[model samples]
Target: MQKIAFQNELTISTVQQRNGANNTKKDVRKIQSWLTLFAMTNAGAATATGIDGDFGKATEQAVKNFQKAKGIPQNGIVDQATFDLLAAPMRAAFLSTITGTDLRGLVVSAARQHVLNRPFELVISQQPNSGPWVRAYMDGNEGREWLWCMGFVQTILDQAASVVGKDFKQLMPLTYSCDVVGTTGLQTGVLFRYNQIRLNPALMKPGDIFLLQKTPNDWVHAGLITHIGDDFIETIEGNTNDGGSNNGNAVLSRVRNFRKSKLDVFSIEGLV
Candidate 1:
């Protein structure tokens, strides 16, 4: 699939500035491209009418059509609310009655499907259910490449939850931000943050998550705990390569130092 071409990446500050009536001609074009790609597949007249950075009648109408479909206000402007609404992509098939009685086991079972080092070509640009690994994860959501770690974890939770007829959101909050996951887990009485979990080889369990930290309050990477030992912990993490760059391109099952790495741990009991 052809990527949405742009000179630079969209940042939170830029996104905030581009919303509503504050949008410039350039902002409008970006919005037009994103909306058309998200809701209408970027072809035909499905909001695909604008690329000239002009919020003309066609752009306005396209925004309105997107708003109408999303059940948001039918204002022909790109507001923050509208931008937020466009973030969610479609979900793939929903499987009911998971055969695994164990929640953590189910998560591991579902996670085993995607291989490490798999490329983005198979993951991006496809119909809801058609794409293999990436499409299956993140509820078949798409966009903003390189943020697949959270999606990978979320997909495991979803697949495991589906087996037991439980809503995935109810089991665990899904988010791209590790801090958000940590915060939500604490608020919901479902997760123990880094210092609280009391991690040791004996204390850790399978299917629990480890949040590798960037700061005490900010977490940068996360992965499932598959095994624990005296000196190291085994993990299945997404977006990590053999060199252990947290921002790498693929999922990997790697071993980490037991005590030296800065990290946070969460129990699976809260999710189960």
Candidate 2:
């Protein structure tokens, strides 16, 4: 895909507008959409900020909040430095502050530690959250009724962060809906879903997340990519097992063949 730069010619006069000023110019409209994209990508600005090209308080406040996050003066102005930050990739921003001797191993190692739980049945009584060993995976995310694969993945991420006494939310946001993560990744330009590319298994690394895209916008299942082999991917997935059922009932390690399955792999190269 060709990289399209966000407008570099965004002048202060081009984006600035008083509370009662008219923002009908085409340039102003482009800047408003650009700002909205920037704010959403950076993760602090509210998504409700309408990209209507109206430089009202909402847009002003959104830009100001973004400026504050970037440690720029809160003058509600989009200067050159601030505009450059807007053009920066979200994946880089998310991982820019992450520090460790080996950042990639943290999550994969944390997930590998939980590879031995049992009885992955699809029935309600024997789900992934049923076992005392894996119950903690669902601690804050799910009640007893939860199936727990997504919870397991979420827990492992946070647990890895805890090993270094750092918060995991800085690396990845907490979410139950795999589709939302997929959607947000696409929207924020942080990740690209592997489809036609049939991404080579060697190209992937640990800490990446894989989504089972059952439909165009629907992601049915997800897991942590612990290791990759010549033809298969070794994954530690919740609510599943060696049987490969997406709705199974335990935290299990499974090897899935990339060439045979319709899985979409998303890289977290600089996102963890």
Candidate 3:
């Protein structure tokens, strides 16, 4: 087994400590510079060029040049991979920080918050059937005509992944059982019968993918698990029915103690 590097751990701890500190802009800039230095060292770039976090002309040029060489969009910003290259230790640190902080709740909470701000459209066109565009429009002040629950889920997962820096693809699968559809599984008094089996609510930790399955369909909607309470699991969903007038938008809603809901709960734990 590969030994965990102490330097990597230390770097992440330092970043966390700095983030926790209520520093002024100047101090924050200083910390950023230090981060850049750390990234440079790990990347094995020459130290002849001073390590500065300013993202100045030289850094910007370097980033653009690197992007061109790698066939990535030359936007000059250090994206995830570029960031990883510059600061492998920091990436390790970031993952450690999340794991150590018991950040599962944070992830769930963040996802919930994103959902509340929902109805946002996704930039990619491939997921049109997923209803991201409809979700985006719904989240907007003006609602649209069509809404697709599956599309809504995709947008939320995408946003959650960006915030948490984890590949959600690795943690969750886009599959729902066919048997758990409408009114068959659980009964809620005389009212709503359990209908859909979305992303496995049981297997969810912070940042895990939560999905919504339409009746008869295997996999439909998607979201990120932001919070998991004893009884309730809050989600940031998109492209939902918002009453009559403001319908067809992305919105965040809580799936109260999802396990208790009349709906059948299927977890993607083993699948992930």
Candidate 4:
């Protein structure tokens, strides 16, 4: 298998920022990115300054606006308190360590947190699929080439497994390709085709990775199953929006009908 590009380093620094001198700091870039994301997700929220890693007047005014909306002091500077709120979503993912025999539940919880946090992509520098969340999920690389559906699934699995002293990589190859993940599941005797699931829906469970199958040998998209209903399954998937395209934007919770879609399941029972 090919190596996973861009190491999965999802973290933010608690550095303070102001208008002058600290303009080109790396943390400034992160703050700008968060400000942009916050503005995008929250309606009527403060927008960011161009995300050019420069803490100019526009960035300061945006920060002040954010502070005012949050009911904090509108000091126009990113102090520890302000930075904490800016990085809350990323921090929320690692806030608690899940402990339980229900590995599926744990994974589902992780995926839910991500969806609630509203991870979405932002076009940067005329490039698509670029942003803090996209870069974080895709390891470090983010662009048009990096469709991050599988990347999000892998990250959620890893997060849940690591909390219980287990490693998901032991069960499946570290990959961003749905086809690669599906192929590995087949080799490991864990892949359940849509037809199999159609006959026995009980075989599927929460946290089981779902792959939208294009062919018997090709899987196009991936996501984490959160609920298995009578004829539909709920999913928390990334790099997708409300339209449910595989290569879209945002982490969203969607209900998909198994009877209508060719969705395959990769059981993580062995890993748990």
Candidate 5:
């Protein structure tokens, strides 16, 4: 495996700036191109097809080809598990190839260790899945409460603070909103609004939180700061199903480079 250098350690302000720059159509296309290149590289496919991050026919066809080769369903869609599998080996190789320091590995390892150290909480209502551990904190039951991914992020933040003997409250006012086409609000902790704190994935340090914006609803998903390599990120998140049944419970999993339409990658309070 080829080792790659991790990104620089980033602050909340810096992350916000990077995310803000992504608002333009050109930037979005650039990000999509990057993602397409990333996916093609791992899927053992050809990037010359010019998928270019559009998620159009070319990308879909590439996904189908990869799926057929992998013997998973030829769904033509890249779900979480498939995304993880495709990127994992390359990421591992990249990390190993990087020299000078093992900062990326250390960060990822720390996040995994943090999840293992905590007791699993039941995701009763919002997330009605059964798993070995609690992935995130859920608000209400299936029909009632909404599943707030940010809550889970907050939970992990709280746990990290406890380990360091710091007050989680001090980490407040973190950016917890998303920037979608028309929606905007500070009330929702999951979405990133304009002027929210953002971080650069390449500059993220250990204990920094990465916020992801879910499509359509524009909800946010949180992951603890871990490893940041040239091509991927390693994070430990709870309540992530990875295409499995919700009953699987929470556990530490490595997340490849995040590929979302509009996301905010920044720190809130804990890491400074």
Candidate 6:
């Protein structure tokens, strides 16, 4: 597969992270971050002590445990091969090139690839919304204050749009707030409210953004619409888990019923 050129603040170099190796703080931190995210999804796997920029005994043991779980050599050393495995999920998602001329097709492909990669947020040192994935999508900002649902949506949109020389920031500002995106969509005549979309289902299309309406004027969360049916829409959302809460962790694929959920549509009809 051709690797798309995507660079983020957390991009790790090819340097190996192993005990007694002269590991830079940047490299060690990336290793710990990968280990942390890996443990969050896998059950009972050993997690790094914390992303403290250290490859201490605990981090080594965690690497060994991760190696064991992966059925690789339990050498407790992060060699080039081991680092490749550790960073596969993130590298695969960011590097994937979705080849197409259709903008909506590109958007759906980008969003689906992210869900397939499983960008799960990590709560390191009791801090919520702080992780490698969160930083990547949120433009190097991560913490409890940075709710990344809209950030994730924008990142995917930006990725898809960039391929065709279209900028999503023009449709809506590059913002992390759902209110900004929702209000911008409304002001620009691109937003279809729940009531309007319920009547005109054709207005909603794959790759259009879905805003979870809090009130008639307020949207609490945002996601990418991947499929639209008679009664439901399949969504790939960020900062949400299996329960579908706006504040939950991870990017998840969810089936949301239009009849039950107050989801407004932000159409990207003319953007392409």
- Cα lDDT of model 6 by residue, 70-107, tens digit: 99988787766787788888777777788656999999
Question: Residues 102-185, candidate 3, lDDT per residue (tens digit)?
Answer: 334444544444443223332122332222134232232112323444334433343334454555334333312222222221
Off by over 4 Å in 3: 1-106, 116-148, 162-165, 171-225, 228-231, 242-247, 257-272
Roughly what TM-score does model 6 have, to 2 decimal places? 0.88
Tens-place lDDT digits, model 1, residues 1-272: 01111112131123322234555665564466455555434344355444555677777788777777777777786655566454332111222223455888877655554432232212223322112234344444444453556767766666676667666676455666678887766676655544544354555677778888777677888888777777677888776679877666556788988577775776667557
Clashing pairs in 6: none
**Which regions in candidate 1 have their CA more than 4 angstroms from the true location?**
1-99, 116-132, 139-146, 193-199
Count clashing pairs, candidate 2. 0
Clashes of each: 2, 0, 26, 0, 29, 0
Q: Which ten residues in a row have the lowest lDDT in candidate 4?
A: 1-10
Candidate 2 residues lying further than 4 Å off, grouped into runs, are 1-101, 117-134, 140-145, 196-203
TM-score of each: 0.55, 0.54, 0.34, 0.90, 0.39, 0.88
Cα lDDT for residue 6, model 6? Answer: 30
- Show model 5 residue runs off by greater than 4 Å: 1-111, 114-148, 173-201, 215-217, 244-249, 259-263, 268-271
lDDT of each structure?
Answer: 0.58, 0.58, 0.37, 0.82, 0.40, 0.83
- Top TM-score prediction, candidate number: 4
Q: After superposition, how far is residue 96 of candidate 2 from its true place, in Å?
A: 28
What tens-digit string does per-residue lDDT give for candidate 2 at 225-250?
A: 88787777888888775587776756
- Provide the lowest-lDDT 10-residue window in model 6: 1-10
**Residue pairs in candidate 2 whose N, alpha carbon or C atoms collide under 3 angstroms:** none
Could you report the Cα RMSD, in angstroms, for every candidate shown? 12.7, 17.3, 15.8, 3.1, 18.8, 3.1
Using TM-score as the yardstick, the better of models 5 and 6 is 6
